[model samples]
Target: MLIDFRPSGRLRGKNPVDFDSAVGPVLNALAAGRRDVSRMRVACDWVQYRENFRDIVDVRPVLPRPDSAESQAGQAAGAPGYDVELAVDVRRSGTVALGDLTAARLAGDDLDGRVYLEDWGLAGQSCIWDFNALYWSALELWEKASGRGYEQALPGGESDARNRGAARELISGLFTVWDRLAAAGALPEELYVAELGVGNGSQAKIFLDEFRDLDQTGERGYYRRLHYLMCDYSQYVLDLARETVVAHAGHVSSVALDATRPSHSLGFLRGKTFLLYISNVYDNLPTDEVAQLGGRPYSVQTRAYFPPGAATELAASVSAEPEELPGLVRRLLRLGPALLADSAPEHIGDTDTAVRFWQEAWSALRLEERYVPLAGLDLYSLAPGVSGEELRPLLESGADVRMHVSSGAVASFVDSLPLLHPFGRLVCHDLFVTKVQDYRVGFRGPGKYDGSVVNWVNGPLLAHAGRRRGFDVRFEPFRHRSGGNIMTMTTQPGD
Candidate 1:
């Protein structure tokens, strides 16, 4: 058995111990008496911090495909043939154990620590977020006043200050454009503004309030002709948003629609809508990360999340088997089961139990990542027939590229473009990374925010995609300050 260990990136400074020296003895202990241990490699992708490397462990399994010529050639050359991947994380100290594999705890500091098994990977995988249907399904439970969710989840909550600034900007830009279009007789009889992911509708209220003031003073009559649509996937959020925007009921309409596929429900608004607004929504959408390893492009494969101890009880209550979470989540979403009916006692049936379990499990969940080759990869579909290749230029960059595919964001942006009136514009504020190198330093997450997943959008890629579609795309710092992390992206029809 031959094992290869490669360090990723250059060493910035002195470390507690060198990568090879720190991990060599631990691997020896794991490999001892294991006949199946053949050729193995460890590509260190993170730097040691405080004598510990807290980073994702990437495990790629090279398996022979029955129909592939490459597999046949490899077999002829006496190459190993298996589709299993073993994840190894070397900590400063601890006994290593994972499903079917175990390593003895070493006594000395000859090598700094032990190699712990992080995950066992199969060859093929899908987007993990696609399967994470439970969190959104159970959203209503955590969106209440007592529930632990976003600041905008509850009714009567104040809108983010940045939202106020965004509203002011929208008013300024839209009013000027409206005047020009009205003068040219190009303006639609009825003006439209769509807000996707309208949490509690506070932002809508602020914008409406500002618009009304401007209309009464300016005598533009734009507000009289305005139609404000609040759209969200969750019916509960839509209801809450509607309540917050009740003052503008005459001009407002609420719809339960998937933001990623807005056209499905909003087709009637094609080329009529004046503005499409989104706030802190793109980061919550499902995304996939791809990397370029040694000049070869590979997709990052995700297994299920590992729950912390605090959430152990909740996780166990919600899912009997962690691997089957997607199916379980779908079932629970359809039928709110207080307990795993088949596994739990009959007395344990209450909806609150299910809701609590869902919230806790989400708070504790942390995704695991591995690398799979790009050949025959299950790239996430953007639109029904759209392929992920639209993002190839970004991921194919020479450096070890790891960036969010933002498939949903791309699809939403692409689909929303056609819905805009001639003078219409799309305005969105989100965590957007403008450079591929930003990922090389550290990719901005799949982080958990209460019950939601927050990932940074690949801004440069989205900008590139917009340009190809003949739209003028621009990115600037968020007008309202909560954090500099948020960037405002605007797209308008090309001249």
Candidate 2:
């Protein structure tokens, strides 16, 4: 059979390895060795291509330490370390290319620790979305200073005239569902609706306002019975949302929690919620992408990089010796620009300068991609003890599967199912790519949006995962907006 190769990374056809050709010998080897043959095997050897990459795999001091200012200053004054070639192990399971591995702090570490990808020409390539998740943890400070985020500054404001029409479409559907539940005597004493990523709370106000209007019609007192839970990772956003929805305070409750791991924070409402509402949140959560090359699947690896000449002055302060870039970036995010400068005044200047430097550095960040062959389908943990084979439908779509493996989205989506009553539904509106063809066109994003990461979610993958869990997943174009790419995903029980 002739093979078709789908290169998720930039290095397409540079290495013409076939999936079937590469997999069969490995399978045969496993069989001869009396090993399990039910796994997806991959064939790869570290090719000696010295020109494209420098080998620093054996460098000393794999990570940076929290040294004194004087010590870091002395290190930064030294010559830069050479970049290395590091390949992480890929197991039989279809996981852990570069994106699945937790980031290390240095280049010579067990895993490739460098964060800047532009130097390696991997800038703008697709990566696992976890970096974006980490990046948002720092935005609470930025938002405090700027008083804005993705939602507040969303193109034309989230509730603009055009967007309001979509809100109506959303509420109309909710009205229909509410009517069905009330008529069937299925509406619980306290009807639950949880909105993840409440943002600036305008969406909640709009939703609550609409619900109140619907309640005025005297259908079944659903509005009075409504218990709306606003959930978000940022306390800053949550507090703001609470204020926005102050008029509906009696019906509203706020939960500061990670949208990805909703189960940990939302376990109290298991099977009690009627609707789990999410808007533009899933796209920001952590995700991993996988691609099939010549029929054999490979997980994509990514590292962050700064573009040349973008933030040269600030970049110079970051240690390029023991590879202090990731560590420095982490410190900058965690401490904020002021504290970071305060802590390292020897080189990083003062608060105002540091803040400016931070913005410059952030805008310069990019991504690099590398594809790693997998051993089989056993290593990826979809659920406890579930094999990666369960995800094949999502990955092996015949065309090159540049799948954004939104593990967080899957976790949140699956966990939220228990949050819903029998007839309850989970409704989410976000930038979603509902087909494989969408990916073949280009990389969706890890787009920087005012200190936050905005990516078009892998809709097809999430739908596939939802189906595996016995839920009906459907995608519809957002009716309120005409030009933007917002799609609504409504999931309910297949039964």
Candidate 3:
């Protein structure tokens, strides 16, 4: 895979290992601190390689703390995206190949303390063996006369390369963005999240499991408390999501909701405040010109499959100026949590990607005269909360991003569910905002990283505002995606 040097200065890579390879310091930390470190794991969904981490098979490296400030700071500080610190605190002083892994803050004499992370690098390529393992395993199977007969269909084989590429693209590109926000999602106390277009709940499962094991210490439910609500237009999908969460065991509550007209009860909506949300609905939304892309007729009909057909359909799930969004978000904040939503740019390939698609798509929508508050609204496009620094990469890379200022009603409808925020938001104690991301410049989308947008959304622009201020907000973007998103602690916004 090729590494794209981002205009933002963050080095872009093909996979996690490329990132780990660049940060050799983390690898060094592990080798050096062999004694004190209790255990460690790759933390992210993919497994990481340190020249020798595999040697210690019996030792299960605990999943790196998902929420932490030190980890989120580097990108906020404009460090290159491909390389970030794989931070961990140890009981004794030691080091790993990735970097100088060390002991955490003492916070007095308490043995139990939190570790602080900093930037580092490793020498090897890190990867997730699970995908291929599953794919290969399935291939071994063949249908039998009594039951069923068929060759095991491996998902990551040469035959499934396209799917694997799609999977990798989906994960490395889109998921990384979510990973950045997850840290904030971890910050909240009680959180409710929603999955907009949850396809068979794959991403939904990933996040639900994440929440099930949220960061917590010392007995008493060792993880933050979470109440999850899932919604999908597909009843079958909703059923799958419900089953997925329930089967996961002891940590999440799931429910179904509709994007067009949310069927969730006000009691549930009013009852629980939302924290973090990870949306991939845009993956299903249509990409067309709202009017024109940067004053141009931004229209492209790709042979590619487009997910969202129009904002109108998506708007169906929301109220234009939902009065409820703010209250729910505020409540979640008051309760303590954040949100993260995932969206792919309308046009996913080549230059002029989906810019014209969204621009034209919006204009084409025959919005109902009833006036949806945030739904069918795109004020965030004209006025976004992301910031000039933030928008810069998307603009430089010509990444198509359509900003929206969804009204309260629509925003509220979506806000009512429990969502997933990536690791970045959850790990940090405080948020650091910036317009530019070093790695973000690669798959760079168009637009200036607008702090105003980030600021605005972090404040008044969003519907989920607890009675107090907006939130302990922070913004860190990665292989950036479509639609604007926010990452908070346990509870942030949306439902």
Candidate 4:
């Protein structure tokens, strides 16, 4: 029998999965049930983080098709038995839970049909994003109820974009580029720079403030001709950002637009923008995870669910039935907190109560994941113009692996690329997994950041997509901060 165990480093000093205690009993049960136990393979994936799913021991029967690599290998070795995939979360399951899961599996309780709610499609299309959108849409209420701003939840309680030194360096680089253009008499009358996901506007304030000061000192006059557009999906964030950059009102404009489809709202600026800046945005965008296992590709499907106990508690909090929770959640996602309050006043008395419900629901929510085979890469769409073929090289780069597609990021990148001037560039700083090996080392998120979802943007995949579009894409460690996961990605016209 083949036993594959993937252990997490987080549980150092502590046994993440004890072979004797956890695997021995399961193997014994399997042997007792089946005569051909020697032909079976058991693969275990253990994670230390709490995912959106609540399953302690998720066991799925892996039946490789006749055409699959696994089956072919088994046929060659004269081993025809099937495989079993076991996924465990140490954060939620203990030794007793593992034993119970083993007994349950022996009793033919695969736990595949058991779910708290309906499947939400692929991970990217999950209703979690709807909750994310509602979070941004009702920022004020969330912040008031949480007693802290979203920015406060970041690693350093702020973004590195606000670093004055980084802003100064970027301003210097822009001035040098603009000076050369000015000398050639190629500079446009109105210089343009846009910042996407302008969180709280502090980054814009730093950039604009530095640009104005440097331009005046250098006598470049670029500041006066500059047009700074602050674009974000949330009007609430835009409003807050507008207030933060009020000093540069003459040169700054707030645009309430979706970051994933910037071209839809800023199409007029195509090929006119000198610089497009993004920070901590791509990671927050929706993404789908794909896994290459047994030489076959599979899409990760997810379903948002509330644990039975939590669901019961949540229902009681809102004075409703557990069956009604899904409808309420759907309603909350469809309508923002304030609207939900007005729409379901009988359940949620006011906006404050609605916000409380949102928080409680968010806390209780979990995602159940399963792997579904893909027909072909061409049939998959990463974004509108981007294809799943872009993920081919990365997925097949090494042994079996799983990585995010960053569908939303790719869409935003593709849409924003056309906005750049011939001599312009796009720069983004966020949590980027630059190497495919990195995904194997640790969890790359789908983790929560305050009220939003975050997954590490697949930097190599983005680079691949950029190169295909006649652009040079590169990533460097964020120069502003010494210790952090943030990486700087710059894209410009390729030679």
Candidate 5:
């Protein structure tokens, strides 16, 4: 048997995992059972985030032989395979979790009452995104109630795009390209530049402000011909951004569109945009995660849930029963807080009360995870045109590993690529896991950032996709920030 332990920093001083209390009890229970358990591998991990949910003890087969009796019985029983590999979550008290595991194992219970919500398919397709959309759509209410903006929750309390140095560098590069195009008499009549996820428009303001100032001194004449587009999913954020760049109103336009399918909305700008800028947006988009264990690929399926106790408490707080909580949460995700309040005035008295409920629900929300086998890589689609074949080298490159497909990021990247001019470049600053090994060492995320999901983009897979499309993709640390997770990804037409 192989045992692996990956504990968080907080667990360093104390015993991270108690083998006698946790592992020994489960092993003893299995030993007493009819099933063979001699070949099992055990892994224990401490999930640092309170927002994440993991089973106390999870068991699965690691590459079961096809002709083995265990495999046949697993098929007959509708089980994935023999539970040969066990994963334990050390977040809960070891003895208590082991007792629960042993009790369920011995009694043959399905562990039903622990689940507050039913399975919702894969993590990416779950209703979490619905809540995420509602959060952004009704961001004004969230910010008002929290007494702070979403940007304040970021590592530096602001986006790196707002850094004057970074903005100046990007603007300078654009000016150089525009200058060359103009000298060659190939510049378009209307110079176009687009910024996606224009949070508060501060980044746009800085870029535009610098562009105008630099143009005045250099006499590039590009600022006069410039058309800046501030694009975002939230009209409220767009409105705030518009006010921030009101000085350059004539030169700017606010576009309310989905970032994942920019081409669907900005098809007119195909090959017209001279530069596309994105900041801290891709990570928030929906993504599915996949993992490889013993050369077998599995998709990480998840169901968003509230713990039983939290569910009862939340329901009681809203004057509802625990059984009625899912429907109410569904209603909250479907409708913004205001509409939910308007729709269910008895339960949620006002918009403020609704917002509070939303906050509490978000705080209590967790994800239960399981692994389902992938049929094939070629059969999987990362985006509309991009294939799961791109994930092949990454997954098989090393030992057992798990990583995000960054489905939304890839779709956005592929769709937005068509909008770039021949000399255009796409610049994005966000959380990126540049190496596959990173996923093996620690959790990348599905962590909550205020009200939205945040996952590290699969940078290497993205680079592969870009290269397949004849674009050169590269990643580097965010130059302006020291000791940050943010990486700068630049995609441009290859030579």
Candidate 6:
């Protein structure tokens, strides 16, 4: 007789990570959740593991398939989009108030610094498991509050009141969208979930929590059973992820690797199939670069929105506009009549500022008209050291960068100087990002109404990066989705 532990997957029959037959006792001990290392031990009943990649010796989790999903269409696409659509058409695109537009932009920066990035950095550290003996014990408190299945946060109204509210709001928004996306085929799998620009592994924690199915005995592949992997360029951040993972089971950290070329540096990626994600990291990586997928199931999530000012403020230490944030938000709400030439018909007389604004604003508006595109277009661009901040400024200043609004035509192939290197397969999702120069995106005045500028940074990246293969992708019109782009397959890679 055998008592089974571990959760089921989208597929049936074989358990994705069950070591029941191989390490029966080990499974029992781990499920018991001992506090000390010596207290935990697994005893497999006469079953010996033959595989090298998975074994009871390690006492870790090894997931076979992707994470599970919950199917739900975006609840707001219909109503929110409809309201914004009418506002864009009748409100006089360039004549709106500019009072709060500046403030809104600055808030994006603040959000990045004080909120999103900072909290995430903290969550990545080893202290995560400190909440309770079981890593999930401490985390589950927050997960229940947010509606997204994340177990690593302190819930709202906890002793740490401020931390609790922040965790609740942020995780709730992120996971609700994420779970719905995975259910919709946007996220590949919960087990192999990867966040390309995982700021703090908050999203990764949700992915793993889902894989756990709220039970330790619920998933297969112990000793190799980790379900989510996070990567970040900053050691300061990745160190946190290492601590969190190692404390619960076992993990490696302090590895240096390039995002675009993760193949050479990413070790776990060696033999397993995985779901990949990239968020808020595009500006740091060159536009032409992409992670090489060797026939593995993966998705890239990116956030185009300038998260609320508090979120962007985490990087305030490195940003130039840290102090100007409050004042900028003040300008965003008003949108017009002052600061923008379009507010006054007579002011449209082509002064450099006004001319630049009109030109960029109109280009974006034209793309907005193409919101309901006639057909998919392949787009590509090649430039060096051009960051997101740089592009936004140029477009606002009237630079003539052409938005590459077509499908990329290059043969899909990974290049290398070392004679011949091989991989299982190659898959590509080439997203056509908006040429920041094309749109005079504004919260107000003659430009397109920015329900929010950072929407592109958040929504598109998270949405599409979570998009699975063979699934049709579309976004709400004028929702500032997709980075105003499209993702296309370029080739069938050869092994």
Give me candidate 2's TM-score against the actual structure.
Answer: 0.70
Ranking by TM-score: 4, 5, 1, 2, 3, 6
For candidate 4, lDDT tens digit of each residue in 362-441? 87787766677777899999999888988999988876677999999999999899999998999999999999987766
- Give the least accurate 10-residue stretch of model 5, judged by summed lDDT: 58-67
Query: Best candidate, TM-score-wise?
Result: 4
lDDT, each prediction: 0.62, 0.60, 0.28, 0.81, 0.81, 0.27
Error of 6 at 357 (Å): 29
Model 2 C-alpha RMSD to native: 13.7
Better of 2 and 6 by TM-score: 2
Q: For candidate 1, list the clashing residue pairs, or say none.
A: none
Residue 184 alpha-carbon offset, candidate 5, angstroms: 1.5
lDDT (tens digit, per residue) of candidate 1 on 242-356? 8888889999998888777898889999988888999877877777676655444556665554433433454356544444444444455455544444434332255665565
Kindly report which residue stretches of model 6 are placed more than 4 angstroms away from their true locations once superposed. 1-193, 213-224, 244-246, 249-254, 267-271, 287-401, 404-495
**Lowest-sum lDDT 10-residue window in model 1:** 108-117
Whole-model lDDT, model 6: 0.27
TM-score of each: 0.74, 0.70, 0.29, 0.89, 0.87, 0.28
**Index of the highest-lDDT prediction:** 5
Q: Model 4 segments beyond 4 Å from truth?
A: 1-56, 60-84, 90-115
Per-residue lDDT of model 3, residues 1-495, tens digit only: 012222223233542134444333444545555533222222111211121111111111112123446435744774322211122222111233323222111111212221111111110000111111211122122112113211121111111111222234333432344344455663345444434445445555665444333332222232344445555544545665566666554555555553424434334445343322434222111111111112111111111111123332322233212223233222222221112011222212321322222222222221100011111122223211221222222333432222222222223323333222322121111111123232222221111110000111211122222212233433443222323232222223322
Model 4 quality (TM-score): 0.89
What does candidate 6's lDDT look like per residue over 214-304, in tens digits? 3345233321434445655555456555655554334223444455455555544543423344433332222111111111111111111
Per-candidate clashes come to 0, 18, 182, 3, 0, 115
